[model samples]
Each structure stands twice: as structure tokens, then as C-alpha cells.
Target chain A: MTAVQIIDDLVARPGEGKALLDAYMADYAPGARARGMVLDRVLVSPPLWMDDQPNTLTIVWNVEGAAGWWGMRLAAGADPSATAFWETAGARLVSRARRFAAAPEDVETLCNG
Target chain B: MAKFTALITLQPGADRDAFARNIGDATLAQPTLPGVFDGGDLILHRQVANEAVPSDAAIAHIDSAVYEPIGGGAHEPGLRNGVYRCLLLAVKPGTPEATVRQFESETLAMPHYIGTIRNWRLSRVTKASGARVWTHVWEQEYADIGGLLGPYMTNPYHWARVDRWFDPECPEWIVDTRLCHSFCAFERSVLNP
Candidate 1:
């Protein structure tokens, strides 16, 4: 499936960072997969970022379409497991900024430009 | 599964390496700790890499997250995965060292807490840039939040026995705490635990 979105939850501490990733994987991944979202990779710092000020993480995800993204959010709200997971996971963060990111084609366009 | 974790910073000039080593070895002890929900510990340096060779000064902080990972996240012993309720602790200034040790021993005793609290841990931070707002940490995990806080915080033993050393009103409360939540990503898990 062609990818539709990417998310990044920038965090400070490793333990908390790890928790963020696991909640996505455990509570959300199964439901998300049924609707076409896959957890692509979990990236940590060093080669993962500059200067190690952010050694925590940057999670990348791929969804089949915008519909799938919305589907996941709605499903999370209705699912007690997902809701509970986020409750604990969300509090661990120092800061979180998630935004739609460039797909491979978008990246290609930028590279060509 | 849910988890709650907390931290505490080691004093300067402390034998930090020994302190870290002691906790590591404690988890590996012959008989498992009671009410730990069959979980173990993972030691981290500044929240990045596992300092297999723990340093006396390390990277200014150390975290001992207790978990029981799913998907075979490791069973025999070591950090496990679950829902965690982590807490940050601030020590009040001038509370004699002996009293602090007394409180530490009291908290660790199993009778004071409930069984659903699968895992509990502590971290000692250094004077590094990674230092947190609080110097110490502690946590316990539960299946769900439900009413864990009300009961745990109000346990007669905790308030009557342990509260003497704590003061939320003090400018520098001898023991100040905040609740947080987290799960084990186990990003560094070699076997995917």
C-alpha cells in the first residue's frame, strides 16, 4: 500500500521514550494494522540525531491512506485498552510533536527540486 | 499491565558504581522479590545506552525500570513490559541521612503496598545535563488505574508510619512526589523483549 502519514513523538528520557513506542505498538498497532497502518521503524539517537541532546526517539509509521489514520484515532477512542494505554504513555513525555511527513514520492520530489 | 516508576539521585562523591551494581545484583538474587509481578530490572545511562560497564560517575543519571515484557520480552529475570505509573521524588534539605535510609527500608518492605503493584524501582542521578527536576524516582504497576492512588496514598501504615518523614507543605518537603505514567518500549531489547 502507498504510505499516507508519518508521526514523530520527540521525547527526553529513554525509559519514558520507550514507553511511548510500546504503547503505540501494543495498544494501537494491532487495531491500526486491521485498518492499514504499520509501525515501520523505531529510531533512537547517535546516528539517529545530532549532538545527542535528543537520544530518546523518533517513531516512523506508514498508513494506507488518510481514512486509515482517522480510523485509528476513532478506534482508539472507543477501545478501552488503547485509551488506557495512552493515559499512562502520554504522561511520560517531556514534549511531543507529531506531524504529517513526506512520503517517498514527496521526498523524491524534494530531492529532484 | 500498568507500571509506576520513581527515581532518586545519589549524592555527589557517592560510590555510584557500587550503588548501580548493587541494584543490578539485587534483581538477580536467588529468591525473587515478593509482589514484583514476576518482573526484573533494566539499568540505563542518561536514558540512552545500557552501561554494561557501569561507571562510578556514569552519564549523570541511572534508571531502573521494572517491567514484564509481552511477546517473550524475557521471562526468567530482567526488565519486563507493562503499563507503568512512574513518579518523581524530591528530597527535602537537611533531613539527616539516617532518616532517609529508614524511609527507604520502610518503602521497600512488601507489607506496606498492595500486590497488584507488580514492580517498583529507584534511580540515582548524577550532576549531568540530563539531570531531572527531582533527584530520585519510584514507581509501581497495576492492571488499571481504577482507584490505586486513593488507597495506596491513604494506607494507614504509609501515613501514620511513614508520613512523619514527609511534608508536602514544607518549602523543601522532606519528601515530595509527583505521579507519572509510562510503558516499556524496550527499544534496546536485544531479543525483542
Candidate 2:
């Protein structure tokens, strides 16, 4: 079966790495799960906390396939919880981006079907 | 040179007969826009049906301002007393002019994808005199309410392709979230002279 991956690249303001992650777990993750997205893992770059330097948070998520991908987007795109989380989290973040991807071998099934 | 449309929502138990009398007596400028309508600068439409699809309550009244058509206007003879839908929206401030034009072009492409629309017009608002500063007015005529709530809403082009401009989660999103999605009944073809 084909699968789709969603990655969120977020940079937290200096001294805000931990606080932003905590807030994401508390506010954003629940809504994401309800929208059919499964959290895979989260990674922080530079491997250490810094008071004066920003930290990059990479969040990985998974869905079944193209149908699942679109379903998640349609739900999340209108979800007020998602909007509220980002608006409120804006204070603790420098920048954020969401990316979609799939495994190399499953690309054909994901795109064609 | 300018197109205007107003979305009016009545209070939950407001008196309709009194409001109709006042609106009928209201003065309006002469309409310069090409289209078939009774003499007036603004045409009043009371919604026959309304439902909130994604968000916000359905508007009860629509005040469409007169103007010369700028870009798109269409009509199909013999389609009358049908659904006339209008969308009032604002492009967020600070979005590049080029991006706004792109969004406009994308919107104008809807007829190509959905064949149910009988008449349509897309115009930019020139005046800002309302509670919300709306930037655009997108109007369409349909054979029935099902034409709008069914194929138009379910088309992939609508939800998948063009919706990104309105979807807050999209990076390409430039439109404000507050929008007036309202429709009403019309006797004559509004997009034809």
C-alpha cells in the first residue's frame, strides 16, 4: 500500500524551542490525529538547547495514500483548531513550512491511482 | 467602472415586511452596468435558500451595485427565476498585485470545469464603504440550487485546485478568511443586457 508523509519544519524563536514543542503537543497534535494523520516522530537540529539561537523542529506524519492525503488536507485546511494553534504559536516561532512526500517505490501508485 | 455587492443578514426574528418597505423606498444611483434588470443602481435579492458549507452563517440579503463589466460576464437564455449566487471576498493586504491577478484568473476558470453554471460575472470592488472592505465580487447563475450545492461544490477543480487560494493552511493562501457566500433568486438574466 502507498503512503504519504507530511513534514513540518518549524523554527522557534531563541529560548522558545521547548515551549513551542510543548504547545504543539498540547494544541496541534490532537487536531491532526482527528484529521487522520498519525504522528511519526519529531527531531530537533543541533542536538542541544540554546538560549540565544533558534532551534529547528522537524515533525513527521503519515497517511495511507493520496485519498488519505487529500482527506487530511481538506479537514486540516478548514480546522479552526489548526488555525488557532498556528496563530497562537506564531509568538514562539520564527518560521514554519509543511511539506508532502512519499516513498520512491510507491510514487507510481500514489500518483497514478 | 466599479462593481459593488452588499451581503445583508437579517437578525433572527427581524420583521421582513417593514424591512422590505424601507428598502423599496431607498434611493439608488442609476445602473451603468450592462444587464437586464428593473431600473435601479442597486438590485436587492432576498435569499430563497442558504446553508453554510465550510463556515459562517448564510446571508439573508444581497445588495448588488451596478457597474460596467470589467472581465467576465455570461448568460444562457431561457434560464430565469433561478439561483443567483455571489461571493464577496477580500485579498489580504500586502499580497502582491500579480498574485491577486493570478487568483482572479484561477477563479474565472471555474466555468470551464463545472458545466452547470448558466451565467457568471467576476468584478473588482472600487468602493470601500462597508463594515468589511471586500475586494471582489464573484457572481453566478444556476438552473437550480442543486447545480450549486452539488457539482459545483463537489468538483475536484473547486475543492482541490482553486480552493488553495482560500485555504488558510496553504502557503499560496492570500484571501481573508471572512467571506460572504450568499445566493438568491432572480427573475431576469443579470449578466445579459
Candidate 3:
């Protein structure tokens, strides 16, 4: 089964939304490549309605398994330098939701199709 | 609270590069305001799919947070707006109402935003396989979603220019309001410390 999580109440900063997302992606890409995790599509778009909310950016990519996802996170937080970048960049760490499953196909077609 | 999963969808033929760029721009544009907290992006891909389904599409996850009421205002922005939607995935299943309410208020009033707006849903998958899948859905809508993009996409003089891209006054449904679909399979994993 697929799990869905929505992180709302995002701060209303001026340019932080785009800045944080860019920094995180730049930091995440290299490690994913090294692990044989292919770089996939990253989508950034404005909210359809709410004016006083943070903008949204949705990313899709592929990897082998749970280990692959963990490996990518480890790479992002691996070095002190990278950790510092994440910290100083000031990208607010909002809520995160994770679902356990064997594969993407086991979830549903809304995200995969 | 027990963490739940969320699935996001993009319009057909949506540009990935532009999507990333827009998210980056919106995040960067946030720090200029008050009551802002943190933000980050997550790139999700389809590792598997049912028969006859394409596994190439990507899903982008961009998130941020804000502080509780600014200056002790009466209007709780988070709950009124939809911030509670985020909290639903955070707090333990048995959290108290006060805490939940607090999170909700902060979410509604947060100031950051993107250029365009689209519909999003929160759900839990109850079943899955190559042939069949099931999910419980929750959807949210914001009236000012386009305000972030309005400054850039529309001319200053026009009040209803969005119709140029698609009709605005016809009351036609432009964005999908429901979160039901069986297009892809998703899995979740935790990031290591």
C-alpha cells in the first residue's frame, strides 16, 4: 500500500521556498548518481490557491529499494560540510511522511502513471 | 503523531525543469518575510508500475514550516488555511487537541508561496499489487494559490488574465479536486541521521 503525507503550515518567508529546494536537490543529486540511483524528474510549481502559503515542489526518481533511499539521505547528510550547508542554507525542516512497500508499482497509478 | 504518506500529482506534459526552477525561486523568495521557518525538496520516482503503466514520470516534494501565531493575532492561519493537513502526518495518533490546533493555525497563515497553484491530496494506501491498489483520500484547496504566480504570470492591469491560459469565469474545473487514482506504486523509507 502507498502512504501519503502532506507537510503544511510552511513559513511565509520571502525567497526561502525556492532557495531551500534548490540547495537540497543540488546536494542530493551527486550521491544518488554514485549509488546507481538514476536522476529523475523534479517539478516546482506555485500553489493553485492559497496566497499565504509556501510554494510547492514535487520530485520523482527511481532507486532499488529502501536501502537506496536511505543511502541517498546518508550521502546528503554524510559530510560535515554538507551538513553545514543544509543548516546554514536555512531550509526549514518541516514534517516528513514515509510509507513502506516492496516497490512503486505496489502503491497506485496516481503517482506512477 | 503517526507519520502518514502523501502522494502528489502533476498535470500532463508538465515541464520538469521549469518545475524545479519555479520551486527553487519560490523557496528563495520566502526568507524576505517574517514568521518563516525551514524548507527542502524531495525527488520521488517510480520504481515499479502495473502492467501497461509507464514508470518514467517523476514527483517533486517541496516542504517548509512556519511559527505559531505572529503577534498573538486572533485569526489562526494554519487551521483556517490547511496547515492542519501537514500536522495530520506529524503528531502521534493520540496527540491532544490544543497541540493539533496550534499546528493548524500556524500553517494557514504562513506567508511563503509559489507562482502557480494546483490541487494536492493526503491519503493512505490500504492495498497494493501489480494489478490492483487502494487508498483513502483527503484533498485541500486555497483561494489565493495563484497570488504567488500572479505577479509574474499576469499583467498588472488585468484582473482576470488567467482565462487566457484557460477560462476563469466559466466556472470550469481547471485543477483536479480529488486525489483518487491508480496510476503508480509508491514506497516510503526513512533518511538516516
User: Which one wins on TM-score?
Assistant: 2
List each model's interface RMSD.
Answer: 23.2, 5.3, 21.3
**A-chain TM-score per prediction?**
0.62, 0.94, 0.47
lDDT of 3 by residue, B1-193 (tens): 1122222333446654454444431211111111111111222222122112123344333221211212112222232221111211223345365644444343332322211212233333333221113222222222243332233122211111221111111121131122222111111111100
Worst 10 residues of 2 chain B by lDDT: B47-56
Q: State which candidate, 1 or 3, has the greater DockQ.
A: 3
A1-113 in candidate 3: lDDT tens per residue?
Answer: 22221111223234456665666567744644664456455555564323445555555546543334344434543444533543454444343221222335543322221
Q: Which stretches of candidate 3 lie over 4 Å from their true place?
A: A1-12, A47-53, A70-78, A91-104, A107-113, B1-193
Off by over 4 Å in 2: A1-27, A36-81, A84-113, B17-68
> For candidate 3, what is the DockQ-based docking class?
incorrect
* Model 1 misplacement above 4 A: A1-113, B1-82, B110-112, B127-133, B168-173, B176-193
True contacts kept of 1: 0.00
lDDT of 1 by residue, B4-27 (tens): 232324445555345545555221
The predicted structure with the larger DockQ, 1 or 2, is: 2
Tens-place lDDT per residue, model 2, B139-162, is 888888777776777555665467
Instruction: Name the candidate that leads on DockQ.
Output: 2
Query: TM-score of chain A for candidate 3?
Result: 0.47
> Individual DockQ of the candidates?
0.01, 0.15, 0.02
